[model samples]
Target: MFIIPAVDIKNGKCVQLVQGIPGTEQVVIENPEIVAKDWENKGASILHVINLDGAFGNKSKNLEVVEKILDTVSIPVQLGGGIRTVQDAMDLLDIGVEKVILGTMAVENPETVEELSNKYGSNRILVALDSKDSKVVIKGWMEKTEKNASELGVSLQKKGAGGILFTNVDVEGMMSGFDMDPLLELLNAVDIPVIYSGGVTSLMDIENLSKTKTFGVVIGSALYKGKIDFIDALKYQKIL
Candidate 1:
């Protein structure tokens, strides 16, 4: 599995929040494009970029930074956050985003998923199945739903999403280990590619995750905080 680095932009800066909470900025840096290039230099094969401001409904100029990041790096980038409309997803993909992730849009306007899939091919679309308290949450993890991750994964896969981005919000950004059973269940529930993110603290976490069937894992605070070396993640990805 690929150990993709996350570049979450909030209020025009690269910030990693704890559990997707607004005030808990663990790693904040200026110029996200530089961070993107740095991650690629450290041997990341792909990047997971999120617009936190967009996710929370603020109209920030983060897209300009995203454009700069696209201009800065050659590796494929998959982005999520505030991509609510079909035009929004198309604009990002037309501008060079390899994949556009859908959250609330996937649940509320599922037909759009099929529309995008038919228009751009399924491989360009990823539906996020982020869970909190074992229930799926959207709109920056503030809006909760009764549906669980695996249930929604099956639904979205049928909608023609090329992949599933499963973020276990219960353990996200805490640097604590996570249980793999729920993840395994989601993996068993869907035939599409799955990308996981959350509490990954050490090389052991990487090794353990590499043993799973996920296509990749998105590491943010742990990588930015230097808990796990990016080069080491790449090594384990190769060997496993």
Candidate 2:
């Protein structure tokens, strides 16, 4: 399994939210370009980025920040949030994002997902399914939908999504380790690669997940707040 460090951008700054709550955010650093470069230098193979503002309603508010990171890091970066159209995906890819994650658009406009998959291929398209209590949330986890993560995962595969980024919102940023049940269910339910995110707190968490078939792990607050160290995490996963 690959260890992917997360860089969530809000207001053009590196920040992390507890349990996906907006008010619970804290700025980790002012310059994410430096942070992304540091993570790459520390041995990260892939960088996962999220636009919190875009997830909420502001679109591409942090594309500049993403651009800066791309300029600084040699590793590939996968981005998600407010990517609602084919043009949006195209623009991000053209701008150097290795992959574009479709979250809200996957649920609300699967046709766009198909178009993007056809245009960019599945390898460049990832569907992010953020869930709580089995129900998928959209518009930045602010709105809960009737669609469950498993069901969404299946639909995205049919629509040609390259991979699934399964995040358990209840455990997100809680540092309690990923909610494995949902991850397992989605992994079993989908044929595509599933990248697990949320609640990764220790080397044990990484070890436990390493035993699974997860394509990668995106760890944020735990690593940022010193609950987990990046180098130790890479070592635990044998990536170091």
Candidate 3:
């Protein structure tokens, strides 16, 4: 499993927010390309790049920064946030994004996942299943859906999605620790690999997560605020 680092971009700057809020940024830094490169240099095999402007229905022209990030990092980059349609996902893949993550689009237009997967191959498509209180949330977690998380996972898997990016919205950015029960439910429900996010606080969490069937864990606030060491996490992932 890969211990991926998040390089979330908002207004052309690299920032990490509390539960993905607009103004509650916990960490902000300039030159997202440098941040992406730093993570690559440190040991990240893949990077999670997000376009907050696109996800939140804002207009920040984040694609410029995303392009810079893609040009800066050699490691495979999996990008998400604000991908609204199949063409957008396809265009990014054409431009060299290793994988394109779809959240709102995947849920609203399930057939698009099948189209993208069929065209780009399933390995190039990832569907985000952001969950809150066991229900799926879309559009940057601002809106909630009546859909159950695991049930959606099964549906997306059936739609030929390559993997799932399961973010527990309830605990995201809290820096406490994630509950394993919910994660296990999704893992048992779907056959595709899942990369978990939210509430990843320490090395113990990393070790425990590494032992599970999770594809990888996306470390955001905890890793950014120094609650957990990225290199140490990488070492643990390799050792296990």
Better of 1 and 3 by lDDT: 1
Per-model root-mean-square deviation over C-alphas: 1.3, 1.7, 1.4
Candidate 3: which stretches are off by over 4 Å? 238-240
TM-score of each: 0.97, 0.95, 0.97
User: Per-residue lDDT for 145 in model 2?
Assistant: 97
Off by over 4 Å in 1: 238-240
Local accuracy of candidate 1 as per-residue lDDT tens digits, 146-197: 9999999999899999999999999999989888888999999999999989
Q: lDDT score of model 3? A: 0.90
User: Which residue pairs collide in model 1, if any?
Assistant: none
- lDDT at residue 169 of model 1 (Cα atoms): 95
What is the alpha-carbon lDDT for the whole of candidate 1? 0.91
Report lDDT (CA) for all predictions.
0.91, 0.87, 0.90
119-143 per-residue lDDT for model 2 (tens digits): 8888999999998878999888888
**Model 2 pairs in collision:** none
